[model samples]
Target: MALRKLPTHFFPSLQHQLRPFSSLNLPTLEPSNDAELVSKMLLHHHNPFHAMESSLQLHGITLTPHLLHQTLLRLKHSTKIALALFNYSKSLPSPPLTSTSFHILIDLLAKVRQFDLAWQLIVEMDQLSLSPTPTTFFILIRRLISAGLTRQAIRAFDDIQGYTQTKTNSDDFCFLLDTLCKYGYVKVATEVFNKKRDGLLPDAKMFTVLIYGWCKIGRIDMGERFLNDMIGRGIEPNVVTYNVLLNGICRRASLHPEGRFERTIRNAEKVFDEMRERGIEPDVTSFSIVLHVYSRAHKPELSLDKLRLMKEKGICPSVATYTSVVKCLCSCGSIEDAEELLSEMVRNGVTPCAATYNCFFKEYRGRKDADSALKLYKKMKEEGLFVPSMHTYNILVGIFLKLNRFGIVKEIWDDMKESGVGPDLDSYTMLIHGLCEKQKWREACQFFVEMIEKGFLPQKITFETLYKGLIQSDMLRTWRRLKKKLDEESITFGSEFQNYHLKPYRR
Candidate 1:
């Protein structure tokens, strides 16, 4: 099949003339059928502007609102096509302009980051006595907020108010506040919230969002102030509201330095107590936050106590809850307890995730208990609980390499492939490092070449292992060949390894 050649404007061409729609050879469009045809052309063509021109040639001066809307929908991601269509529609004797068509074009322009054109369309709509819909305002507001144009978003909101003469709902206000908070504009969000709250009765969810915003910025005091203000305004806080504040307080406390760790944990505990006393029932998330505080404070026993209390309260522990307790138990050198909890989690019909297994793997690896780690790996496979991830293989590889069991390493590597887990950069690095450590220069070289072929550039540690292994194995000639290939590929090995000379292996 032969490929169709596009026109010169599709690519950069100095000699190509830019012409109006009237000068182009366009088709006369049937308002009903040709809109669908134009839509198809825009979808399949390389230059949608050219597609629009062709459609115009087929349906001269018959551009319909439906056709323009369809074309705009197809070209929403292209600013050039949108502007071309806009200009082409303007050239018609009686342009088929409607609110729906203008909305589509404005949305298309906004999506392509041509905000000025979209705003101009809104102004034009106003002049024509056409009020923009809520959807049109939403699209503009979201785009402006996403682009970090808070001031422009505020202006648009005000404009929307003037156009509709109706009060904005809680969802709209919440969206604007959330966007401002997400982009670290909490102060601006507060001002916007205050401005809107005067006219609209602020709800619990709205207050919760503002509290979360303050908490996100580590302003716990400010968050608390809002909480109190909400109560003063006779709004009852929900479980979600309490959980948000609890999580924020616990997170801030966890980040305190060692000297302040105890003090911070105590503060988090006080908040937890207060939450329960306020008649707000603690959920799994609330318990998880408190459990995390206990873990960070090096109080695994306390975490276990809380776990008991959680069950007593009939709050079923989630996978995250089990994982947290398991992690704390492992950190405190209580592997048996952690393993017992893992079984308990399964018995309760809650499947352990990758993170749960990783906690056991890391603990076993740290203790140099490869046998236990392997048993867990086999158990993971035998139980069909979850497929072993790259981290699982990496831990096994590191352990086998440390024990100098190259044969087992090879077996695990084969198992990794048979299990359908594609090796990432870390996997390749580990295998190459393992092969080099065993002085298997030829095998290491093969893996190195394969790694490069897979498009992963070796890091400094990879090169260091290869350099040391090759020099010690008296494979100087092979090293020179590898260096030459690296140089040709423009791959750097850093200055430290670059200056090192090959010395004769001392027997």
Candidate 2:
């Protein structure tokens, strides 16, 4: 919610400096929930402490029980503000807050490792005669897991029946699996599934999450085994299940692009084929994945065949689909063919992103054809195909810097800032590294200072390389000044780093 006046409801960290949103229509959000309404007033209009008193009076809308819950959930990500609002709400002369309300506040407290306070409130809910819902335990379990209290999360789940009146259902089982899998606790989630597998009959979703969890940790073989188990036990795998395995297979295959790649690719194809055999038609995501694998294999023909098959199947190829085929064509030196596909994609109304254009730029970059690369970049900007993202700028700057084109690098750097793409750590690193290579120690020092002030920690190698240049130029005063700044910022530069004066640049 970066939009103005309506509120930065999503990102509390980025809530400041509400930019003018002249292009936006405020009335369009007319039915925007009370959550956004109060959130806007609280965050944008008044101070956090006196917000409910002033802004709610000003807004003149009542905070109903449902609205309060929604607002709490909306601000759940911002624990401090949410806790303040909850505490404030408790003092209000409205209906007594429910067990569910206490659950959210407990969640906020638990996130900050204030588990003692959270449990006290949980006990207090019982005192208030509020019956605990399964969500009471779910909230505790989820937040406990997030806090890396894995055993505690499981304990909370086990204590669910003892606390909450509601019996755990399939939804609860799947929810726990989903939550655990989300945090890369696949093994633990599996253990819970096995222990609780007595009376409860599981579904495809239960198995899918386990597959997803296994896939997330790069265990493609384990994911494959789950798929086999599902099929053998008369549990049917859907498009989502197949898609997950295919993604895992493609990812593994991409990494092992040596002798193992072909075998891995064959496995992906088998899962893909199994989908069609089971009457599960591949969605755009499935097709795009297959296209990506073909791109990695550098099979331009196979990539085009897949693209052709997609159109034949009446499935629209996405920007990702075109980008994959472009990568394949570019890899095999079919620049003309890739360009033709890009045009085809545009004609089909799927706008090319930075990645789609980056493929062409990369081809020219590899050939050291700076003129052709810049030409394509210029054409894209002028034609309004897409704005070059920070990543695009980073790549363009690297290309210029590699060829020692400092003048062009400076121009691109200025343009990048002008485009409102603030230089991040990677951008600063690229510019500082490039400057060091050119013996522009002064510029490197300035940018390095800016980088540090912006809370970016430079790599030890980069720091040493830049400092070595300063020392060689007899700039000990400059070194002392920078060293003082580092001390104030509580950043350490050990004696070994300062002793870069003795050794030449390692490279």
Candidate 3:
């Protein structure tokens, strides 16, 4: 399908809204602002160009490279919309896009299954003597490494070794190390980093990516060690570096919460304070994370306190900052307070994403507040700003099932399909879990079968729970059907459901 050319009115509107970069001081404009504008523009549905034009003018916003980058970073997972903005911007008359834009977009094409288009973009870049730095080997390494093809990623890395720089000191080396680290190949990424580090000049961003890799895999100690090593080299760990470490501590605590949950929260707070001590004031990300830390520890007071401190310090709270506080409020069952904070977020000009509202759905589920959840869902549709996502429907269905509102579960399920939201892994997991809890073994088995039929490998735990439920079920026909399907899938109540994974195909 051809995307319509930019409407005639778009250019003057965008150009007028965005004063020439020089006049407005491009240096200070954060990409997140532009990215958010683009994100909201996506709500238009018909033409993203029109959506973007109207959104920018409606908000009287300007687009600068920095703001665009931040918004794209936030919308990285919203690839379709991001690419739409990317394409839409290519047709614009002001604030010309850069090769860096192409670099990240090229880096992301595989994620959106745009292999041929990715190549075509590369070819176009090559024609302009601006390849955005992707060799075929780069894409191969990313895809192969992502598939746990470490040997192949390495082999492909070797294929592009004809460049002038020595293998260890090249940008290719950094790319290889970074990609390796990104996919939980941290052990291997560490090996690659160490081998390259013997005489290689240190780069903080390179180290930051590795630190994030380790932290991503729940190895906070290794992340800390890297931080220490970076600091010892007379290199200052930037705010981003600290945020990575903060996330590491938060992840470690989340995974190993002893019900007390205090230890991790303390460690996270220590990191937050350490940032201040080092003259690296915690940014919005830092506050948001600590907010999450406080929330998880069930310290709603601490969460609220940090939120106020965020405002007092003049650190503008990002959507994440507000959402984390909202989540905490909802989790702590301060539903009224949560609603107020959400309102505050909007009044403060922070647009709520689908995730922010999902927090409320989760709370409604906890309290079996179906009417409230349904009311919110209706409002989300009517408001047209933040569309309910797959997570939304899954939460709604889960809420109904938990409340013993089975009829509404069917309604939500149909609505989900109608809206083209789910039946994804979480959807299956929630359904299976909900059905098992309700002892609705027959419907549970039905979804279990359909889940596998759709090529979603069932989580072993869910399979076990369902299989056990089926065995205990009085519905003999459904049990036999599920048993036959399980046989085909190599899943038994005892075995790891059909075995081999697959969090990133399950990473």
Per-residue alpha-carbon lDDT of candidate 1 for residues 1-507, written as tens digits (9 for 90 to 100): 111121111100100111111111122323455655565453345342152553354354466676676556544434454556676676677877788777776665564345766878888887877777655676677667655678988888777678767666766677677656655567888999987788877988688877877877789999999999999999998777777677667766654567577776677667768877887666777788778777766688889999999999999988778888888898889888888998899899998888788888888888988889888877777878897777788788888888887777788888775553535556777778767766778988987865553334566667767877787778889988887666643422223234344444432
- What digit string (tens of lDDT, one per residue) describes model 2 on residues 400-494? 98898888888888777545454655688788888888888888898887655433455566667777778888886887787666665441223
Question: How high is the lDDT of residue 272 in model 1?
Answer: 67
Order of the predicted models by TM-score, top scorer first? 2, 3, 1
Best by TM-score: 2
Per-candidate RMSD, Å: 16.9, 11.3, 13.1
Sequence-dependent TM-score of model 1 = 0.50
Residue 338 alpha-carbon offset, candidate 3, angstroms? 1.3
Better of 2 and 3 by TM-score: 2
Candidate 3 global CA lDDT score? 0.64
Pairing residues by index, what is the TM-score of model 2? 0.60
The local lDDT score (0 to 100) that residue 64 gets in candidate 3 is 62
TM-score of model 3 (CA atoms): 0.60
lDDT value for candidate 1?
Answer: 0.68
* Native-to-model Cα distance after best TM-score fit, residue 164 in candidate 3, in Å: 17
